[model samples]
Target chain A: MKDNIKKSYLLNIVGILSIYLILKLLIGGNVLNRYHISIVIFICINIILATSLNLATGFLGQLALGHAGFMAVGAYVSAITAVALKSSGLPDTLMLVISLLVAGIFSGIVGIAIGIPALRLRGDYLGIITLGFGEVIRVIINNMKSITGGAQGFTGIPRIANFDNVFWITIIVVGILYALTHSRQGRAIISIREDEIASEAVGIQTTKYKVLGFAIAAFFAGIGGGLYAHHLAFLDPKTFGFMKSVEILVIVVLGGMGSLTGSIIAAIILTILPEALREFANYRMLIYSFILVVMMIFRPQGIFGTKEFSLSSFLHKLRYNQIISPRKEIKGDE
Target chain B: MAILQTTELAIQFGGLRAVDNFNISINEHELVGLIGPNGAGKTTIFNMLTGVYRPTEGDIKLDGVSIVGKKPYEIVKQGAARTFQNIRLFKNLSVIDNIKIAYHNEMKYSTLEGIFRTKRYWKEEKKAHQESLDFLKIFDMQDYANTLAKNLPYGKQRKLEIARGLATNPKILMLDEPAAGMNPQETYELMDTIHFIRDKFNITILLIEHDMNLVMGICERIVVVDHGKIIAKGLPEEIKNNPDVIKVYLGE
Candidate 1:
């Protein structure tokens, strides 16, 4: 048992360092250039957003349509903070961190406020309310003429987010999310997703867990939004509108509701697909809608469904390797 | 003495009183059965007891404290756990995770610890997994620890539900028609499991079962109901011989 844990820990460290190296290579790689790096960063941000939304929608089985609203909250809060604090001579990295934290806290607070009332509402009613709340947020941002710059959006923000920073943060956020979904609390939330009554019977505080999911999703969306804001050095209410929420939802559904790896894969594919089809940009949405319809008809659960790729499961396959090669020293035989 | 008591508990939907003025007292570690005809308010009573619905009028007391309007989770926290008539396992979650849901009430780590994977998180997670596996082993479901709940057979799913309830560590565990769709052999196995759970855990059990053989063999006391009222309450032999029970069963 101790050996298994030690091996797992060591594997985790190696995995982190390798990802760090890959991220550095991606950013510093001359092959793809600057535009591709920006695209990669944006893809990471969307993956973070969609994965967080999947926690509430896919794993928690709550249809939330206002995720973009949460993103907007994070974006604006971080934008305002970075701009206001820029003169204090704080390091750019510190400013970015503080802004992201502010955005997370603000978005989380808003999420809780919206979640408290909507927790009791079920199914489509929840979807509608959440959608309404998102719209309300967009309108609020649009109407806050002075601070948000209204329709003109918030601009002149510092550009602290680079490919490397965004990449590291994305890895951290993904790790955090992955760990959470596999943890005990994640199981409680997923139980509620399965059947509310059964979950309640098992003594899970369904309301508390539901809200926890929403707050956690909001926190990540805020962080991602902060990254987005700093990446662009400008923000607009129009960009973080209802359509953005739908786009994230598409990523989640296309990925598979309860599959973490599925969300990441879907985010990457969807993010790049539009850029790849730049010639038919207007027809891209039409094709996207058509694909969604087709997918729903044949495979409504999405690509990976609810399966997670576990290291333990991979380790279990080592016996087959031994069966194929009896004499060779198997790495799994340690 | 009764650990749980209901006084004149009533629930109504429109004009149909699903459960009317239902009263029962359950002692600690007692295995009691609730039996009835098709619409005898058996499930309604269970729902009321578990706080799925507030009684239109009445009092449900746990350890002498009224809990008529408490939420389902609050009732659970007050030492009441339950399994549904329909198996309701988190379909996508692993068998171990299904049991871990029940342990949520006892988790000491905050959201911060969970997000950060702090030391406290590891401690709580280790405890939760070990505890969940302990319950799973009772039903010989340890091998399928990582298998999704929905993939399990019907019998295993039923057992998993019971295991999940036990994970709550409740003083009172309620089973709603556990043998609803089981085969004869499965039903027989379930009866043995129920007895084992009652004796080993030393917890009170309130069960709803249609199978007379299983109920008679295991239940210390049985309560028979018709429409929305309790018609008979006694030992298995007494209930078996009750004219009112016969009438309801025969639709006379």
Candidate 2:
């Protein structure tokens, strides 16, 4: 069993790395144009945002609407750090790494600060509180004229987040989140989502897991923000407003809350959908709204529900005969 | 020695005393039942003992150690675990995962260990998987280990709840309406399982049950309550004959 687990982990890492390499090769060979590369990078950033939000909303069962606030925090902080380090003649990769880490940690700290008190509220109450917090964050950024450049936007952030960098970082973020939710701690978080009272009764420190989930989610959102800042070479408080948070939430809900794969899939589709429909550019928002409304009416639990797509499970199913396997019967029970 | 004891435990929601002057003493390996009519504060008493409600007044001790004012998970760590009146399994999770989650406090691997899949993580995870599976086997649910908890039949869900409670390795297990929705056959099997666990685990059991037959058949001693106060306490036969218990609880 241990060997099997180890093998699966290795397989997953290899699978992701190969995909990264393939994308890198395509881009380097100029098979993918610059416009497509930009879209791919945007998709990666959205993936990170959606997965992180999914941790809070999907796994922890907490509706958090201040995700973009954390992202803004990450974006500004990392961009500032990268800009400062650029003058120091540090390696670009090193500067980028430090900036992302700083952004993630700072955002995580903020997440804890907010999450501790905010988690006390549930459902829509929590949502409203987080939404207020996001606005508050944006307002703070807006007023900090010297540091954040006010409504004019913070500029001159180096474009360090190319397709390769953002793609790899997204994989790492997704991997960490996946590892967490699959562990004992992750199970505890999920249990809280299932039933908080029961989770406490069964010896899970509900508050601790709740905070952990929120903090981790915030950390990744921050990373996404940092990547966005570097990719776009700009930062605006307006970009991290409540609408941005809602956009991420929409991705999570559309992807299936508890499934990481669902988030990835939804992020890709949502990011590219507007650009792909460039011919009807004027109607993009309408199209997006229509799809969301239709999706909510038809598959409210999201596309994947809480079930994740597992490569090992898929392979195991293929290896065994459907007619002879008890596993098949077990799957049928679901 | 008593494994769990509550004295002068009381709670008031505004002016109404939800559970006033409630008391219970459960000895090691004893199967006890708390039976009361609807809204008789039976579940409220369980709530107080499990730290869901801080008593407006009173003391609760486990092994002579005061556990009053501790958190619910803290109380469980001190060797008490419970099932809810409504079964509270992690519905989306698998049956084994449900039991494994109850073993959360028991897992010694740190967060870093889990993330890195350290040697300790692998060893502990394998052990947890085996232990959870063994626990499911006790209820003849080993085959359903991979099945989602919500997909399980109602009777099995209840059984799984108990299984999960036991996985916490509590010295005293508090069950709320274990037989509430069970058919007679399931209830009968539950009774056997309860007996088996008490003997096998050498743990005291405190059960809140609405079914008189179930309570009377298994519980060596029964505590009957009405209006948040104990009206009668004695052996099952004595409780059955007690006029106050019959009037308040049996509605005779």
lDDT (Cα atoms) of all candidates against the true structure:
0.84, 0.87
Share of reference contacts found in each model: 0.83, 0.82
User: What RMSD value applies to candidate 1?
Assistant: 4.0
DockQ of candidate 2 against the true complex:
0.72
**Residue runs of model 1 more than 4 Å from their true location after superposition:** A26-29, A279-299, A310-334
User: Counting only residues 3 or more apart in sequence or on different chains, how many pairs clash (N, Cα, C under 3 Å) in candidate 1?
Assistant: 0
- Lowest-sum lDDT 10-residue window in model 2 chain B: B243-252
lDDT of 1 by residue, A85-118 (tens): 9999998788888999999999999999999998
Question: lDDT (0-100) at residue B233 of candidate 2?
Answer: 95
Instruction: Tell me the spans in candidate 2 whose CA falls farther than 4 Å from its real position.
Output: A315-334, B250-252
Error of 2 at A123 (Å): 0.6
**Predicted model with the maximum DockQ:** 2
